[model samples]
Target chain A: MRATLALMQSRLDDSPHLLRLGRLFSETVLIEVDGAEYYLTFRDGHLAAIAEGPSRKTPWRFALRTDADALAQFWQPRPRPGFHDLFGLVKIGRGRIDGDILTLVKNLRFFKEFMALPRTAPQPEETA
Target chain B: MTFEPVTGRYLTVTVQGRRQRIYVEMAGTGTPVLCLHTAGADTRQWRHILNDAELTATHRFFAFDMPWHGKSLPPEGFQTEEYLLTTDAYIETVLAVSHALGLDRPILAGCSMGGRIALQLAALHADRFAGFIAIEASDFQPAWYDIDWFHRPDAHGGEMGAALVSANISPHAPDAERWNTLWMFMQSGPGVFRGDLSFYTRDDSLIGRLARIDTTRTPVHLLVGAYDLTCTPEDARRTAAAIPGATCTVMDELGHFPMSEHPAGFRPFFADALARMKVADHV
Candidate 1:
């Protein structure tokens, strides 16, 4: 998940569409990978907010505190084999989505596009 | 033998309210071939064949995604129409691109779903292409239609075990290389497994439709990987026998993915197909 997240960050830098968005606000995201949970954040085309501190509780921990059963429903993230279906990874009943649902729905396409970038290539050096 | 090498290009296409990412690798410069990938693999699997020293000299090849599998979109929901849309969308896209490029009916070559779509496209829209080369594509049994294959112990266990065991089998490969391949699918998690398992379980009687195809017009060739776990050589042979005037060849020392696993074996067989197509054109 970290590797893919890193690749997503790299692609966002080169994204023409995203460059137009300018800097984004910090939003906390909790992504579950394999069997582990992670707290991640995205803003300004960079992953600026990952959980720090020991006993790191995921952002989803907050979501679970609010609604435990709802969090359970989100855990069954079934990623589609098709490229279009990948966006389902972050959608409702897919990933452990929390916070502003409105923002997520509105900007889902941008986020999905970021995830779709070819991850097979090596992480290119940052260039001005 | 020398031509401009094809580079992989990534594009976004929106399907059913979802924006999907797809990669297309177009090589050579003649009749276009839409190379289809198998289950559990992306268009990357066609790298060797698309860049083949012989085939590149004669044909233009294009390979891309089939929705949620590769760089394409994941499922909105698993429905037959969605799966069918994946094929139809690709064919339409290829056709439109070909028309814009001013190209004619090119041959279709596929493995597994790639092969399944070759047969499907030929059956529904035969006029779209010149011929088909289906490798290990005709393994579906009638019983498979009734079975809940996703739940099958052998299928799931085998798929996971195959990756781990195969990686271990390769001594020369570095640990990172093995993990790279294994992690690619593993990271996708159980959702991908269930989705693909459901996808593979889908099979219908294209046998009758296949027989109705005019072999003289659209020459069909069947290639089988000798040790194919999913689609056996015998099944391929049977499929060929059923299709009027279709030819079958069993590639040695290979399994379900002969194109990737044994390109040396594929070269001559593919070369022979090109030759036969040329001979037919002249005659």
Candidate 2:
């Protein structure tokens, strides 16, 4: 999951359109995979930090939770229905999103494209 | 419980005073359903719907490949030209094909670009269709992504186009379905996708025009896939809200190509839309 966050960061860094989409705001998002947590801090449209195991200092504007199985399926080369997207997973009772709903909706396209990074990002073996 | 095989053939139709051959496939008997495929796609996109035993039993399905698409080759003088599908040409071809086939107020079903056309048909020629089922359709889209990569001269034969389309398919879809979609993408003729996008992303703006749709005479049922980025669920909902009594269904776990990418998963939503249409017809 930490590796996945790293991959997401690199993908966001590489996309100019994504950066522009997020340029209007800054926020901290928490992604909870099972019991483990990761904090993603965005400063002025760029990903500033990807800290693991949660943070006591900052309050997350948005938080999403799902099990390890759901997260793994989401990152698969090809996903099946319930595993294809965050909303799809939520609809099927496999995932949940809490905290600031407006923040999520305001940057819906940015977040959607951001989460889909793994699909286009180079595989670990390919990079190695 | 059993069904016969679907039959396919080519039909010559005159559209805008120009003669062209179109590939048409049909199956079953009862209320006729004239299906329109998405941009850069052909009648093959309707294979799942055509082959569905239950759907075929109650509905006679007709799917056709547009000119320069699928097995339907463009006519003479058009062989060397760059093809750009305009909204006028698309509507003309659909009307011409329906007229040539002598279809009587068939229920129109379409997806993506085809879906936009279905909405247009309901608006312009409401009396010509019993009801129109539009999947992944909306009035306006604020061009979310940059599609210049699709028009790159070096990316002919749809390599980059296929890759981009593959990304839109839901990752949860079956492996076979995913590969089948890729096959369709790879099979599209060069520049056909970009040409189709001209109408999809540019000309087909049915925003204020949606209120002209008569829901009582011609019921419009829109089904948008939850994962469809091009025509998001919110877009469909907004479109539905503008049209009086127009129904909208947002299907979970489905993407842009709902009918083809994951037909089995999309079946329930499709079935529900048809059921709603039937109820509307009786009303």
Candidate 3:
């Protein structure tokens, strides 16, 4: 899980378009996977830090909760129907969305594109 | 020094008793195929079909931007009432456009909201059309979230529409084509997408009417994309299963905006459907 987050951060850093979209976008998005938590903090659209959580300290604007299997399926090179997208995950009962929906809607494109980075920009086999 | 095979025009039609100017595009010259786009989008979605050498050679493609979408501006005094796409208004406009264009029993091809309408047309007015291709559609599709966000001033309707619908396109789709599909949604007029969704998502579905669909009068074909969560393949299959003799297909590597998102991948399925329609017409 930590390895994937590392790759996600690396991929996020290299995305010029995402950086452009994230301009002045500062927020903490919480991603909960199988009871484990990952707080992705973005400063001006760049991923500043990804903090792991078993404790409650970081405040998040929105939280996307899913199992590890669902997250893996979502990040696949060619994900199946009802598993290829964030909303797809939520719609199919594989994932959950909580907190401010309007915030999620506002940064929707930015969120969708950046989250998809790990898939579009593939990493070495070792990472997989 | 070249131009696209497609040409654009405008015609005035009365929708729900109000005079409305509609923008339409067309290409080719065989059997007429009336194309209908998804919600918040316009006729630009059919550009690929209109330009396809093979399709244009065998079939005439005509697509119109429903009033308030694309170059088809909303009727005068539109601001007076909240915009909503009721079943009656939608059918009225489609019939008016078909009549105005002199299309003789054209084949109806619609996607998403357009798809639901295709089902309605088959049930209520089957003899008027040759066949129905309802792509990425189902009888009942409840929106995941509130529909109000699509039109409210505080929220950015265009971006939200683009973002939400983008989920329905396949990840393998060409970047340029994908962006073009999103751009159309982004260009939609305020409340226009919401208006369409009013009928598509919030309104009563075609459940009670599906059993009444007589495919022999007008064959019904439901095609869905693998990635369209809004109206998944399961939904299309279920809808098809209910309608007697209606056929359903799940298109791999395609999504809701198949026509506009990736023409190369979309054309084969569409061409195959057209062939089936032609066969049905002869029988």
Candidate number with the higher DockQ (1 or 2): 2
What are the per-residue Cα lDDT tens digits for candidate 2 across B53-119? 8988898989999998899988779857877888788889999999988998888899988989898
Clashing pairs in 3: none
For candidate 1, the per-residue lDDT at B211 reads 76
Task: Using TM-score as the measure, name the better of candidate 1 and candidate 2.
Answer: 2
Model 2, position A14, has a per-residue lDDT of 95
TM-score of each: 0.54, 0.71, 0.94
The list of candidate 2 runs beyond 4 A from truth reads: A1-128, B1-4, B145-148, B279-283
| C-alpha RMSD of each candidate structure in angstroms | 14.9, 10.4, 3.3
Superior by lDDT: candidate 2 or candidate 3 = 3
lDDT of 1 by residue, B58-131 (tens): 78888876555666655455543323334455455545534543456777788865786677666666677778
Candidate 1, residue B95: Cα displacement in angstroms equals 5.7
Q: What does candidate 3's lDDT look like per residue over B183-215, in tens digits?
A: 999988888888898899876658889999988
Candidate 1 lDDT for residue A9: 66
Query: Which whole-number lDDT from 0 to 100 does residue B81 have in model 3?
Result: 76
Let me know the DockQ for model 2. Answer: 0.10
